[model samples]
Structure formats: structure tokens, C-alpha cells
Target chain A: MNDQLIALFITFILVAIIVVIGFMSGRDKKVRSSVEEWSVGGRNFGGLLVWFLVGADLYTAYTFLGLTSSAYTSGSLIFFAIPYSILAYFISYFFLPKLWAVAKEYRFTTLADYARGRFDSKLLSALIAIVGVLMLIPYICLQLSGLQDTLQVAGKGYINVQVIVIVSFLLVGLYTFFSGIKGPTYTAIIKDILVWAIMLFMIVSLPMIHFNGWNPMISHITKEAPQLLTIPSSGPKAFPWFITSAIVSALALFMWAHAATGVFTAKSANAIRKNAMFLPLYNIILTLVIFLGFIAYMVLPKGTNPRFALLELIHMSYGGVAQGLAYATIALASLIPCSIMAVGASNLFANNIYRDLINPSVNGARLTMITRCMVFVVIGLALLFGIFFPTALVSLQLLGVAGMVQIFPAIVFSLFWKKQTREATIAGLVVGVIVTFSMYFAGKSFGINEGFWGLVSNIVILLLLNPFFSKRAGTNAIKQFLFQK
Target chain B: MRKVLLIILIALPIISQLIALPFVNSIHPIIVGLPFFHFWLVLWIFLTPLCTWGIYALQKAEGSID
Candidate 1:
């Protein structure tokens, strides 16, 4: 335990060092002096940086720990994760390029910008902003929780979870506040390097090292825990929850402020399209990670907290150095996305609410300053909530996905549906949100996930009501949309 | 050609899963050594770049710049 604690301490120090160095790279105080610099990295990311930045941001701690826990507990159902990312990239490829085109034409920065620009509706934009900020809080909490869990297990004897969370965020906030998007941008390069090495090495080495080969390992898992290889839950309990969660996750993934944040950073709409084309290879690395989760389940003891499978596997087999590398990778995984998510949520408040609503006369520098301050506030709230609520990481994650996904029709569909009136979009959004929340809370109380119920009602209300308002958008709107090409 | 390639790429995963689990179960050689699902995803990734590049070239020649 003391050894694990030391290892975790070393990992924390490494992240602090990397982040500070990255932040120091933003020495051109001229660039660091504006919202464009702070929020979107001066609106300049080439394919190389964009690839790593988007890759690191999208493939998150949830991918690292949450998916593994699922693969460990359930079986082939984990395959849903791999395919959906492919589908997500495909969907984003078509829609995002068009979005990028519109954004460039109008100088739109956030998804709220795009929403308002398309609908000519400030109320709809505000509503989108509200939903985005609301969903962002829990997402940040989950990242902090992932950091906390990793530290708690990796450094059990010496440091406390609260201290690790505090130290990690403090370092994270300092760099993000100083450098904004560029801080995470540079660090992502390091993150991906470690990610690629560790992912490739483990997928190739451990199966052969621990159990002879892939086939033999699968045979071992089947003999030991056959249920781990198939969807184990029956009825509405596990399977329905799992299936609904998958669909919901795939739908909501890009709606998160960070997804758009990444999208907005690309060089062109076409770059967004091209990156989306090849993005699922990242999923292959994720496959290795998820499979490692099952391998851990087959090997680890009964109550081994399933979340720490990858780190523990490295530790148990390879000892402290490799464990340190794995621990550092997961820790930074949480940290980089933590910075990005906080920054995204901060931008929504600064650009949409504070600038658009409260002041309307604030300068870009002041807006950037407010965003930094709001980021601190967002991170503070997340840490407090994570410590106080401490429910389950998986549940908080699902709720995050479910909540954000409720915006899918509004954001994704609106781009191609210019006839989507601001008023009608709001009507659908409001009704969709209400049904989603009511079902979510009612189901959650009854020991089921709230999202499944909420989404069902939300989708029904949206489809049932869309046609009634569809005709109001007019012929001009239809021509703009149906002929976007 | 582009649409057909993407369909084949996307279709590989669903098809490979059927082959890998509950069915053949030991049918190797999706690409010789890669497991069926992993192999199919790799194929998808490899084909995606080629497909997109071709589509990009075609679109450029057709003046679809925006």
C-alpha cells in the first residue's frame, strides 16, 4: 500500500511537470491576451495537433475505467462501444463539416453560437447554453472521481483522495487558466505517445505473457466465467439498461461541449470530415483496454474494485515502473479532459451568458478572464459534488450522457433542418427535457436508470410534435436545408 | 464507390461479431492473426482514409469546395 501511494505521488508530480511545461510554451502574451487564445487556442490547430487533442479529449477516463468495468462484469455487449464510436464519427463527418462551414461563415465559436445562428433565436441559444452547463458539472465530477479512484487505489497508504483531487485540480487549473486550450493541446501529444505505447504493448505483450496466447486466454475466461463473455442480464434490469445506455451514449457523445470544442478547433470543415474518417482506429486501442478489463476480471480477486484492473495488471505483473507509466497515463487522461471540459463549460458561461446576456458590451479579454474564473468555479463545484455525493461513477456517467444526449435533435438535426424554427425547437427541447428528467428521476428512484425512460418520452414527444410545427418553417427554409450541398 | 466502401467497412463489425461469437467461435484469419472483431475494425480504419481521400479528390474536381 505504501508503495502504491509512492507510485501515485510520482504520477501526480509527472502530470504537474508536463502541464506546467505546456503552459510555459504559451509565452506569447499577445496570444494569451484574448478569448480566442484562451478558449480555442488562437483558433489555429493543424491536423497533427488536432488529431492528438481531439483523440485525447474524446477517448477519456470513462473509456479507460468505465468501459473496462462493463467489459469485466458483462460480456460481448462491450462491443457496442467500438461500433458506436464508428457510427458517431460517420454521423459527425456529414453534419460537422456543414456545421464548420456555417461556423466559419459566421465566426461561430460554440455550439450555442451555431444554434442561435441557424435558428436566429437567442432564447433557443440560452436554453442550449443552460443544458450544456448543467450537463457539464456532472461530467467534470466524473473525471475528478476517476482521478480520485485511481489515486485512492494507486497511493492508498500515504495520501488521501481529497488531497490528490485538490492537488491534481490545482495544478490543472493553474495551467488551464494560464494557457487555456494550448495547455491541453501540447500535453495531448505526450498523452497520446504514452497511450499508443502502452496500448500496443499491453495488447501484444500481456495476453502472451499471462496466459500463453489470445485463444488460450479466451478459453480460460470461458472455462472460468462463461457469463463474462455474453450479455448476462435478463429483462429490463441489466440488458435494457445496458442497451439503452449504449444508444444514449452514442447519441449524446458529440453533444457534450467538449466535442464541439474539439470540432471548432479543426483547420477546416473538411479536416473535421477527414479526421472523423479515421478516428475509429483509436477505438482499436480502446478494444485492447476493454479486453484487458475482462482479463483482469478473470484473474483478479472477487472484490477487486474492477476499475483499477489495468493499473493493477501492470503492477501485479510488471511492478512499479510500468505501473507508474500506466498510472501516469490514466491520471493524465483524467487531467487533460478535465482541463478541456472545464474550459468548455467556462466558454459557455463567458460567451453565451456573461457576454451575450449580462454585459453585451464586454471585451474579448474581459470575457477570457471571466472564462478562467468560471472554470475555477466549475471545477470547485464538481469537486464538492464528487466528494459529497460520491454515488457511483458509472451512474453519474450515464446521467451525464443521458442529459447531454437530450440535445441531439436540437443541435444535430437543426443544422440540416433550417425549417426548424427557434420557437418550435424550444418547444421540442422544453418538452423533451421535461419528459427526459421526469422519467429519469422516477426510474432512478425505482432503481432503474432515469435516462432510458426520459429518452423514450423525449423522443416520442419530439417526433409527435415536430410535424405540427414543421410546416411553419416555410419554403425558403426548406430550400436552404434540403439543398445544403 | 465511396458509399459502397463505407457500407462494407461499417458492415464488417456486425458481420464479424456474428462469426466470432456463438457461431463459428474459432474462425481465425479475419486477417490471419487478428481476432475477428479487432481485425474487422482495423480493416474499417484502413479503408476509411482511402475512401475519404478519394471522396475529397472527387469533390474538389467537382467544385464542392465549401
Candidate 2:
């Protein structure tokens, strides 16, 4: 067989193993009779399980491909991911444990659930849920793009990439529908192990394979592409964009509903805290992961699409089996997180939209089923969006981060600021979202991330109007929420 | 002490940006084949967790953890 066929054969075996693992993970877990069990894994996950789940949930295929691509195409701007994630873990260190506590006490399954109870407003909860689902759809699509990139590189000309992409996601969707959080959590272990091994292997081998050594490679790149090592190298990614994007993206990281689901699954507040402490270890590998792109910069010809830089580099460097393993890692990166994201979005739909708004009388089993079906719907929408609107993938993903960060004022701030009223928060959210889109659409980041600008308006509105609104509404509800501690 | 470490943890990421630490962003001092800026950030990625562990340990000791 040719290299493509061998790679395909290996990929099929790896994917089959993942699917079996995904399905079998749900077998021994508690009977998922309710939406809670399916959505949050019965909220009994220990530190290691939570670590794998949240780590996989946070670091997607996008992190693998996108960072390498950015580092290849642009310069030091890709460093935004490192500090941003570090800041995210730091910020979550303070709030996630508390959020977990409140979530457990109140039986909260989604961020919207917390918003509803915190603000005593179903509209606010529904609004948060709607925004989450909307933002997550594009993120899910971005994962599909990640998978597509891997398949395109690995399959080459022998396999129909589109068919495989759709079929692979459909398989992931099925397992997610059947197994929910457990599916992803189990698969995450395998994915993380592969990711670590592959990343370590590449970090060690790629430099040696391409150049004589690391210093010579650095010297060669510095001599040839000096600007690749610097920031603002004739690109839109200025220093201000780097700094503000890091802050906003960090805040936005845990705001995703899937991230919230990951945190909620932790068995204790201490687990969340401990996870935060250790999560950065995973990120260290990520810092090393970017070296793959730097290696690509030297090996690949100019004008190669940066998105395909990493995979193509692997294709050029390694044998069919190694390439298959790398391809499967990226594919699993997409699948594992997509499963969690689907579960998260569907939970919001079934709980916040259907139960809260449409039918309060819906029982638990039916709710579980609705969430299960909504998993298909969510992934289906993302797939359609990925297929139809391919060009806008990067922008939509950025906008998703921008839009989701707008929820910080309503969700994170309310944890401490008991004086924040639903009116003020709703107004802030509306204004923040509007400002985020307007700035993005109008091409006005002013060198900072568009989302940080939105957050400014969000906080301003909340600070200005919250006192006025909360006095009339009274802090009784807010006091009740705070007193729940 | 925990409060101070928490503040430091939150501030470290932005402080490098806000001040534009010249010594950190330069390319001359490459540690482990990484630029100073990259190395600085990666250093913090490893350190932030230690800081977090300190805060967690302190909080646990105080028995204020919930």
C-alpha cells in the first residue's frame, strides 16, 4: 500500500479504538437516567478525571493547529495563548471552586442555571444560555475545521476528506449522545496521553530532523525570517492586541458553558483548586508545541497555508504510521472537545430553554432525551455552518470568544458584587455584546482585542446603572444568593 | 499571605504587558532556545500554579475552604 492508504488504515484503527472507548466509558458509570447525570457526569468526577476532562475541553485541536499556524504565519503574537491560559487558570483559581460550591448546592447544571438563581430572573438565565449556545456553535465548527485539516493532510488524495470529516463527527456525535460527559472524559485520557507523547516527540525530533540542532535552526530562522521572532512584524497583531487579547481571552476561557460543565464535575472545591495548580503543567507542553510551527517555517516553502503547516510538516518528516498517529491525535483533539461542547450546549438548550421557558412540567428522563437529541442538533448545526461558511471560521471563532466574554459581568461579577441587579446586568450584557460585534464588524480594535473593548462597556454600564437599579429592586434577592454561602 | 499571592497571580500576566518589561521581551537572552518574551511567559505558566498551590495550602490551613 501507498503511504496514504497505510495512514488511512492506521487512522481507521485509531478512530475505531476511540469510538469503542467513548461508548464503553458510559457502561460502568451510574445509569444516566436524568439530564444531570448525562450533562455533568453526576458531578462526582475526581481530580484526575476532572483534570483530563477540563484539560481536553480547554485545549482543542484549534490550540494544536491554530497556534502553530499563527506562529508560522505571524510572529510572537501566538504567545498570547500562553499568558492567556496562565491568567485563566489563575482567575479560575479564585472563582471556580466557589462556583462549584454554589453549583452543587443549588443543583446548577449550566452557567445559565447559576445566572437564573443568582439574579432570580429566568430571562437572564435564558439569555446567558442562548449566548452560550450561539458562541459554542462556531467553536464547535472551528473544531471541525481542525479535524478537516488533519484529514486533508493525512488522507491526501486517496480518501474523500469531506465524507470522512462528516462521518467522523457523526460518530463522535453518536457517542456523545449515548455517553455524554463520561464519553469525553474517558476519551480525554487517551487523547491527552497521545497529545503529550506526540508533542514531546515532535519537540525533540522536529528540530533535529529539519536542522542540525536547535541553535542552528534558531540562527537560520533569525537570519532568514527575523521578523518571525518579533511582534508587530508588519501585521495587524500589535502589542496592544497581544496584551488586551490575552486578558479578554483569559476571562472568556472559563466562561464557556463546557468549561463550566468541566468545573462542575469536580467532586470537591479542592479538586478544582488543585486542578488549577496543575493545569499549567499541560500548558508547558503547549509552549513546546509552538516549536513545531517554528520548525515548519524553515522546512515548508513560502506561501504554504499556515493552517496546514504543522500537519504537512509531519507528513514531510515522518513515515506513514507516525503521520497516522499525529493525524489521529489532532482528530481526537477535535472529537474530545466537540463531545464536551455538544453536551454543554445541549444541556443549556434542554434545561434553560425547554424546561425553564417551554415546559416546566417536563420530567427528568424526557429532559435527558431532549438534551441527547439536542447534541445531534448542535453538532449538526456546527457541521452545516462549517461546510457552508468556511471562510468566516476564524472570525466567527474570535467573535465567539468576544461574545462569550461579555457574560463575565453577569456571571463572574455577580459572585462577589451582590448589588448587581438583573436590569443592570442585562443592560450590560446587551451593550457589551453590541459593542463587541460593532467593533469587530467595523474593524476597530484600536490594537486591542475587540472583546476587551466590549468588556469595558459592560463593566461601565454595570457599575453606573447597577446601584440605581439594585436599590429599587432591593438587594433582598442578591442578599439571599450571597447568604446561600 | 494568600491574598497577596492571589493578587500576584492575577497581576503577573498583565504586568509584563502593562510595563513592557524591556529585559523580558528582548531576543538576546534566549533561554532553552526560546526568546526572552516566550521564556518569560512559560516561566510564569509554571510558576502561577505554584502560587496557586500556595494559596490553596494557605486556604486549606485556615479552614476557610468550602
Candidate 3:
């Protein structure tokens, strides 16, 4: 068989195995009886499972694609990815334990659930949920683009990439709908293992194949394209941009609904803390993984779309089964996180929007059914966005992160500060989102990320409104939250 | 002591990026195939977890693991 056929065969078998794993994950457990169990594995996950679940949830195919692409095009600015994640783990170490405790006490399923309980405002929680679901659509679409890019590399001329993306996400949507969070938790283990193996192989072997050694490869690139190895001083990605981007991205990372869902699944606050302590080890591998982008830049021809650089290099270096393995890895990376995001989005819809506002009397089982159905709706919407407006994927994802950063005041800060009123938080979120969007359109980097400006405005509004709002019962809620342990 | 340790654990990663990067932003003195800036970041990437583990140990000692 030809190279394409070999790739197609390996990818086909791997996809089949992943799909089977998805369907079989929740079979031995009891029936998912409520939105709680369906969305968060009944909140009984130990540290190791929560680690894989969040690892899979946070590091999407975009993580691999986006990081290497940054390395290929930008340079040392790629350092933003690692530091942000390290800071995210450290920050979450402090707060996630507390958040997990309160979430468990209140039986919260999503971040929106926590906001409502903590702030005593269902309207604020509903707004948080709307931003979450809206932001996640583009994120899910980004994963679809990852899948689309992988299939394009693997299938070559034989298959239509669009059909493959639709079918693959359809398979993901089905299992997520059937098994909910359990499906992604099990598949995450497989996905993480495959990603590690393939990435390590490419990282080690590609440099050897091109320049005979890693050091030689870097030295040669340094001699030829010195700018690719050094950090920038001015223009779009300068030092200030890196600092602000790292800080803002770290602040926003765990604020995403899917990440919060992962935290809520842990069996205890200690489990979450332990998981955070060790999470940086994953970033060590991630820091090394971006070297693949540098290697690709050194070897591949100029002007290759930085996004496609890594796959194209693999196809060039190892023509047949190895190429298939890399493509299969990327595809699984996309699908695994797609499953987690579907559960996160659906839970927000069922618990916060539908049950909270539309049908106040909805039972737990009925809500589970609604969440499962909403999983399809979420996937369909993502699919529509992925197909019709493919070019908007990058901007939408950046905007999604900025938009998500707006919620930090509502969900995370409210856990600590007692004086945070619902109205103040709502204003901060609204104004912060507007600032983030306007900054993006007006071409006003001003040496920092737009998300930082959004966060600044968010905190500003919160502080400006703090003194005006008199003491309320919410002050006691923080005391209760602290003394509960 | 716990508060100092927690602050160190969180601040170490951020300080490394915002302070250390611009200070050591150069391509020379390539250590083990990586530039000085890359070496600095990678070294701390491995170290940040140790600081985090230290914080976790303190939390456990205080009986405040949560």
C-alpha cells in the first residue's frame, strides 16, 4: 500500500479504539442519574483521574498546534505557554482547594452554579453561563480545526477533510452525550499517552533526522536565522506583550468552564491540591514539545502556514506509518477535549439556564436528559461555526479567552472577598468584555494583551462599586466559607 | 511561614517570566543547545513544581490540605 493508505489504516484503527473506549468507559458504573453525575463523574474522582481529565480538558489539539506554530513563526515568545500554565497551577493550588470545598458543599456542577450560590444571584450566574457557553463554541470550533488540519495531513487526496471532521466530532458528540464526563476521563488517559509517545518521538527523532543532533540543529538555526531564537523588543510580540499575555492567560486558564468542571469532579479538596502540585510536571514536557516547532522551522521550506508546519515536517521526514501515528495523535487530541468541552457547555446550559430560569421545577433526572440533549446542540453549533466561518477561529478563540477572563471577578474573587455584590460583578463582566473586544478591533496592543486591559477594567469597576454597596448577608457567606473546614 | 511559602510558590513563576526574561534576553552562552533565556525558563519550569510541592507539604503539616 501507498503512504496515504498506510496512514489511513493506522488512523482508522486508532480512531476505532478511541471510539470504543469512549462507549465502554461508563458501562460498569451505575446509571448516570442526574446532571451532577453526568457532568462531573459524580464528584468522586481521585487525584490521578482528575489530573488526566483536566490535562485533557485544558491542553487541546490547539495546545500542540498553537504552541509549535508559535515556535515556528515567533521565537522565544513561545515561552508564554509554559509560564502561564505553571502560574495557573500555582494560583489554582491556592484557590481551587477552597473552590472545590465550597462547590462540594453547595452541590455545584459548573462555575455558574458556584457563582449563583456564592453571590446569591441566579441572574449573575445565568449571565456567567451564557458567556461560558458562547466562549466554548469557538473553543470547540478550534478543536475541530485541529482535527481538520490533522485529517488534511493524514488523508491527503483520498478523503474529503470536511466529511471526516463532521463524522469524527459526531462520534465524539455521541459518546459524550451517552456517557458524559466519564467518557472523556477514560479516553483522556489514552489520548495523553498517545500524545506523549508521539510528541517525544518527534521531538527526539526529527532533529536527528534533519541536523544529526539537537544542539547542532539549534546552532545552525542560530547562525542562519538568529531572529527566530531571540525574543523581540518592539512590535506586536515584545517583552511587555509576553508578560501581560502570560499573566492574563494564566488568570483566565482555569476560569474556563471545562477546567472548573474538572476541579468539581475531584473526590476532595486535597485531591485537587495534590493534582495542582504535580501539574507543572506536565508543563515540563510541554516546554520541550515546542522544540518541534523550532525544528520544523529549521527544516521545512519558508512560508508554510505555521499551523501546518509540524505535520508537514512529519510527513516529509517519515512518509508512511509514522505520519499516520502523528496524525492519529492530533485527531485524538482534538476529540478528547471536544468531549470534555461538550460536557462542560451542556452542564452550564442544563443546570444554570434551563433548570434555573426556564423550568424551575425540573428534577435531577430530567435535567440530566436535558444536558445530554444539549450536548448535541452544543456540538451542532460548534460544527456550524467550524464550517461556515473557518477563518474566524483564531480571533474567536482569543476573544473567548478574554471573555472568559471577565468571569474571574464573579467566580474566583467572590470566593474570597465578601463585599462583591452581584450588580458590581455584572457591571465588571459587561464592561470588561466590551473593553477586550474594542481593544482587539481598534488595534491597540499598547505593549500588552487586550485581556489584561479587560481584567484591569473588570477590577476597576468592582473596586469603584465596592464602597457604595452596604454590608449584606454575603459577608457572612465568606465567614461561613472559611470556617466550614 | 505558610503565607511566605505560598507567596513564594505563586510569585516564583510570574517573577521568572516578567523579570528574568527581559534581564536575560539574549542568544549567547547557549547552555546544552538552548539559549540563555530558554535555559532560564526551562530551569525554572522544573523548579516551580518543587516550590509547589513545598507548599503542599506545608499545607499538610498545618492540617490544612484543603
Candidate 4:
């Protein structure tokens, strides 16, 4: 057989294995009895499982492919991912434990549940749920596009990439419907192990194979394209944009529904803390993956599509089995996260929007059913959007982050600040979402990240309006929430 | 004093990443065959976890993690 066919065969075999693993992960029927169990693995995961789950959930195929592509095209701008990840863990080190404790106390399946219970506002909960589902569409699309790019490189125009993406996503949707968070949590271990092993091997060996050594590759970049080595001091992706994007992206990381789902799955606050302490080790692999982009720059011919830079490089360098294994790793990277994202988004919709607003009388089993079914809807919508728009994956994912970060005031602030009010949070979120999108569309953000502008406006409105509304709202529940556990 | 130390530990990674960017954003004085810009970030990828580890130890000692 030819290289493409052999690679495609191996990729399919690996994909099938993960799919079976995903299904078997939900073998315990008790997991499907309640929304909480299905959405967050009954909150039973220890530190290692939580680490793999959050690692797989946060670092998607987008991180693997899009970061490299960004490195290839825009150079040092992609390095924001490293610092943002570090900052995210630092921030999570403090807030996630508290959020997990409150979540445990209330059986909160989603962040929206916390908003509803803490702020005493179903409307705010529904709004957060809606915003979360909406923002996650682009993110899930990012995973689909990442999968699509991987398939496109492996297929080499012989296979129908679109059909494979739809089928793969449907498989993800099915397992997520059956297994929920457990599906991804279990499969994530295999995916993370493969990702770390393959990425490390590629980074260390690829330089040796292509350019004789790491020093030679650096010398080649310095001699040929030194600009790829440094962030520009001016322009849209200048130093200010880099700093703001890192800070804003870090702030927004946990706001994503899938991330919160990962956090809520931990068995104890200590598990969450320990995971935060160790998760940065994954960033070492991520830094290596970003260097693959530089390797692609040195090796791949000019005018190659930057989106396929790393995949195409793998195809060119490695044999059929190795290339296929690498492709499968990327594919699982997409599938595992897509499943978790589907669970998180569906939980938000079912618990916050459907139950709280439409039917307060819904039973636990039925709520779990609705959340499971909504998994298909979320994945289907993301598949559709990804097929049609298919913009630059990194920017779209960032745009999603920009919108999701608007929820920081509503979610994070109410954790510590006793004076927070639902009215201010609601109003601020509305304004923040609007400003974030308008700034994105208006095409001028004065060299700062669009999310930064939205956050500024979001915070200003929160502070100014919070005092006025604090007098009317009661603080007893706030005190209870603070003192819980 | 512990709180101040914790705050500084948290700030160390962000400062090294953002506040110290311009000074270290150079292609010269390559360390281990990497440009200073990339070297600094990669070095922190390892060090930032140490910072988080410090914070974890402190928090554990302060009875925050039990």
C-alpha cells in the first residue's frame, strides 16, 4: 500500500480503539442516573485523573496544530500560550479550590448552577448557560477544524475528510451522550500519554533528522528569518497585544464550560490544588510543540498552507506507521476534548436554561437525559459552523475566549467579593459581550486584545453599578456561600 | 509575611512572561542554541511550575490544602 493509505489505516485503527474506550468508560449504568454523575463523573476523580482530564480538555488539537500553525505564520505571537497557561494555573490555584468546594456543597453540575445558587437569579444562570454554549460552539469548531486539517494531510486527497470529521464528531457525541465526562476523562489518559511521547520524540529527533542538529536549525532561522524569533514591538500582534492576550486568555481559560467541568470533577479541593501544582509540566510539551512550527518553517517549502505546516512536515519526514500514529494522536486530541466540551455545554443548557427556566419540576433522570441529548445538538452545531465558516482556528478560538471571559465578573468576583449583585453582573455581562464582539467586528482595538477592552468595560460597569444594587439585595446567602465548608 | 510571599510567587511567572518581555525579546546571546527570546520563555516553562510548587507547599503549610 501507499504511504497515505497505510497512514490512514493506522489512524482509523487508533480512532476505533479510543471510541471503544470511550463507550466502555460509561459501562457503569449508575453514571447515567443523574445529571451530576454524567456531567462530572459523580465528582469522584482523584488528582491524577483530574490532571489528565483537565490536560486533555484544555489542550485540544487546537493547541497541538493551531499553535504550531500560528508559530509558522505569525512567529513568536504563539508563545502567549505558555505564559497564559502558567498564569491560568496560578489563578486556578486560588479560585478553583473554592469553586470546587461550593460546587460540592450545592451539587453544582455547571458554572451556571453556581451562579443561580449563589446570586439567587435564575435569569443570570440562564444567561451564563447561554453565553457558555454559544462561546463553546466556536471552540468545538476549532477542534473539528483541527481534526479536519489532520485528516486532510493524512488522506492526501484520497479520502473524504468532511465525512470523516462528521462521523468522528458523531462518535464523540454518542460516547458523550452515553458516558459523559467519564468518557473523556478515561480516554484522556491515553491521549495525553501519546501526545507527550510523540511530541517530545518529534521535537528532539526532527531537528536532528532535518537540519543535522538544534543549533543548525537555529542558525538557519537566524540567517534566513530572524523575525520569526521575536515578537514585533508594533502592529496588531505587537508587544502590548502579546501581553494583553496572555493575561486575558489566562483569565478566560477556566471560564470555558469544559474547563469548569474538568474542575468540578475533582474529588477534593486538595486534588484540584495538587493538579494545579503539577499541570504546568504539560506546558513543557506544549513549548516543544511550538518549536515544531519553527522546524516546519525551516524545512517545508515556501507558500505551504500554514494550517497544515506541522502535519505536512510529519508526513514528509516520517514513514507510514509513524505518520499514522502521529495523525491518530492529533485526532484523539480533538475527539477527547470535543466529548468533554459537548458534556459541559449540554450540562449548562439542560440544568440552567431548560430546567431552571422551562421546567423546574424536571426529575434527575430526565434532566440527565436532556443533558445527554443536548450533547448531539452542541456537537452538531459546532460541526456545521466549522464546515461553513472555517476561519483561522486560533483567532476564532481567541474570539470565543474573549466572549467567555466576560463571565469572569459574574463567576469569579462573586466568589470573594461579598457586595456583588446579580443586577450588576447581568448588566455587565451584557455590555461586556456586546463590547467584545463589537470591538472584534469593528476591526480596530488600538493594539490591545479585544478581550481586554471587553473586560475593562465589564469591570467598570460591575464596580459602578454594584454598590447601588447591593443595598437592595440580601447578603445572608453571600455570607453562607463564603463560609461554606 | 506569608501572604506577601505567596503574592510574589504568583507574580513571578507573570512578571517573567509579560513585564520582562521587552528586555528578553532578543535573538542574540543564544543559550543552548535558542534565541534569548525563546530561551527565556522555555526556561520559565520549567521554572513557572516550580513557582506553583512553592505556592502549593506554602498553602499546604498554612493549612489551606488539607
Q: Best by TM-score, which number?
A: 4
Indicate the residue-level lDDT of A331 in model 4: 95
lDDT of every model, 2 decimals? 0.71, 0.85, 0.84, 0.89
Q: What interface RMSD does each of the candidate structures achieve?
A: 4.9, 2.1, 1.4, 1.2
Clashing pairs in 3: none
- lDDT digits (tens) for residues A1-485 of candidate 3: 99889988898899889998898876854536777788888899999999999989887889888888988888778778777888888878878888888878778889888888776778988898999999999999999999899888788788998987888889988888878789989889988888888888887888889999888888898898888776788887798888888888888988888898898999988788888878877886677667888888888888899989878888889978898888888888899999899999998988899887789898767888889999899999999988899899887887888788899888788777766788788888989989998999998869789999999999999889877764654444644775555
How does model 1 score on DockQ?
Answer: 0.25
* Candidate 4 per-residue lDDT over residues A1-485, each given as its tens digit: 98779999999999999999999988999878888889888899999999999999988898888888888998888898888888888778888998998889889889999999888899999999998998898989988988998988888778898998899999889988888788888899999999988988898889999989888888988999888888898776788998999989899999999999999999998899888888877788878888899889888999999989989899889968889989999999999999999999999989999998999999877888888999988998998787778775567777888988999989998899887899999999999999999999998899999999999999999999999999998755645868555
Candidate 2 similarity to native, TM-score: 0.96
Reproduced native contacts, each prediction = 0.14, 0.66, 0.70, 0.86
The deviation in Å at residue A297 for candidate 1 is 0.8
DockQ list for all candidates = 0.25, 0.62, 0.72, 0.80
The worst-scoring run of ten residues by lDDT in candidate 1 chain B lies at B18-27
Off by over 4 Å in 3: A28-31, A472-479, A483-485, B1-10
Backbone steric clashes in candidate 2, count: 0
Per-candidate alpha-carbon RMSD to the true structure: 3.9, 1.9, 1.7, 1.5
Where does candidate 2 clash, by residue pair?
Answer: none
- Chain A TM-score per model, please list them: 0.90, 0.97, 0.97, 0.97
State candidate 2's DockQ: 0.62
Cα lDDT of candidate 2 equals 0.85
Model 3 C-alpha lDDT per residue in residues B21-48, reported as the tens digit of each score = 7888888899977888788778877787
